[model samples]
Target: MKHLDINQIKEIIPHRHPFLLVDFIEDYEPGEYAVGYKCVTYREDFFRGHFPQEPVMPGVLTVEALAQVGAVAILSMEENQGKTAYFGAINNCKFKGKIVPGDKVRLETRIIKRKGPMGVGRAEASVDGKIVVSAELTFMVGQAGKND
Candidate 1:
């Protein structure tokens, strides 16, 4: 298992700051799969209003985190360097448990298929080895800085 710090991850994917959900990537094979983690904290801006009482991690954001992992796997490819993978579709998603502060969420995304500029990835987020979210994500690679 290889490891990539946030700096290395940033070189592969464009996401940054609060939007860069994956804190560290443990292992990833370009155009194949990515394994990463996010350390949830109460100090997060989302917790301030996502719920003052419950503070559950937003489901959509969890999926976005997975997509970011997929982006790393796809963008890390030598030929695809500096490209941006945009969400084309999200299918068959499921949420089984709540994610709150103090949880270290495990994120995994595997590219199941790819044809030209489009591809599909199987993504999931788990905590304590229990899957809390899963989805089949579709994406389209576009040139960096493209408006579309």
Candidate 2:
């Protein structure tokens, strides 16, 4: 198992602030599973509009965060690096709780299956051990080497 700091994660995924939701990857097992964190802050751009007085991380962003972590997990596999994984579909997605400012949300992803360029996985978001969201995500991995 390995941990990925923000800088290392930046290398694997093309996401940045306001969009780069994962702050730190806590644990990762190549070709298996990965866990990451997102610390919510009042300064987040969406909070300004989502609700000025009472800010809460939107459900969509929560899902995106999970997806980003999943992407890192899949790409970290030796066979997938330097490849772009495009989200193909999200299935059985459910938002169970609210994520507010000051919350540290943990995202966990597990590879369910991988066949050729397509892969399927399950992801969940939690805060203080409480699940907030979960989904089954499918994506296509396009290797840069292929067209280069």
Candidate 3:
């Protein structure tokens, strides 16, 4: 079991501020798989308008958290360092339960296959051992030159 703090995760992926969702990664294997967590809280900006009384973490954001975890795994690789993984497609995504503040959403992603810059990952989000969302995500890794 490996671990990555916020700073270490930032070294791999370029997301920042409110949009960056993953809090910590506990299990990571470069280019293979990773498991991370997001600590949902009432202070989140989206909770303000998503619903005033009953706030729920949006399902799409949950998927994005999973994608960020996937990026951590893929970008941590030596060859893929300083790169960005963009979403190519999302398939078979299903949300089974509601996720609200005070819940910790555990995100896990594993690369199933890859060809050059394109790859597929099996991703899921769970809370208290209950599956909340599952999806097969397609991604394309990109690297920018100093000028670009």
Candidate 4:
């Protein structure tokens, strides 16, 4: 298991500011699972237009955050290093609650199946111990420029 800060996460994934959703990785196993966090604030760009009176994080972004956590688990593997994990599909996704500003979201993704460079992860995101989102994410790992 390993704990990763923003810089460390950058080394593993190609995401950058304004897009990198996971702020910190609490702990992660190379190819098994990862637990990460995202601190939502009123300062987020989306809050401005999402609603002036009520700022709710978008459900798609929430799902993306969960996918990033899963990417950490997939890309961290020794054999998969330097590879990018692309979303193959999102299955059974559900938004059970709203995520507002000031909410600290806990994201987790566990690799439940794997075959070569493709796999499925069981993902969930919660705030204050209450689940807000859950889904099964399918991913395909491949070199950045080469299609395979």
Among these predicted structures, which one has the highest lDDT?
4
| TM-score, structure 2 vs. true | 0.93
Q: Write the per-residue lDDT of candidate 1 for residues 1-148, one digit (tens) a residue.
A: 8789999999988889889999999999999999999999998889998999889999999999999999999999998998899999999999999899999999999999999989999999999999999999999999988865
Error of model 1, residue 10, in angstroms: 0.8
lDDT tens readout by residue for model 2, 1-148: 5889999998898788868999999998876778999999888999989988889889999988998898898888787877877788999999999999999999998989988878888999999999999999898888654642
| Position 101, candidate 4: lDDT | 92
Model 1's TM-score against the true structure: 0.97
> What's each prediction's TM-score?
0.97, 0.93, 0.96, 0.98
Models sorted by lDDT, best on top:
4, 1, 3, 2
Each candidate's number of clashing pairs is 0, 0, 0, 0
For model 3, residues 1-148, the per-residue Cα lDDT tens digits are: 9999999999889999889999999999998999999999999999998888999999999999999999999999899898889999999999999999899999999999989988999999999999999999999998754322
Better of 2 and 3 by lDDT: 3
Q: Which regions of candidate 4 fall more than 4 Å away from where they truly are?
A: none
Which stretches in model 1 have alpha-carbon errors above 4 Å? none
Give the clashing residue pairs of candidate 4, or none: none
Candidate closer to the true structure by TM-score (higher is better), 2 or 3: 3
> Could you tell me which 10 consecutive residues in candidate 4 have the lowest summed lDDT?
46-55
Those runs of model 2 whose alpha carbons end farther than 4 Å from true positions after fitting are 143-148
The RMSD (Cα, Å) of candidate 4 is 0.8
All candidates in order of TM-score, best leading:
4, 1, 3, 2
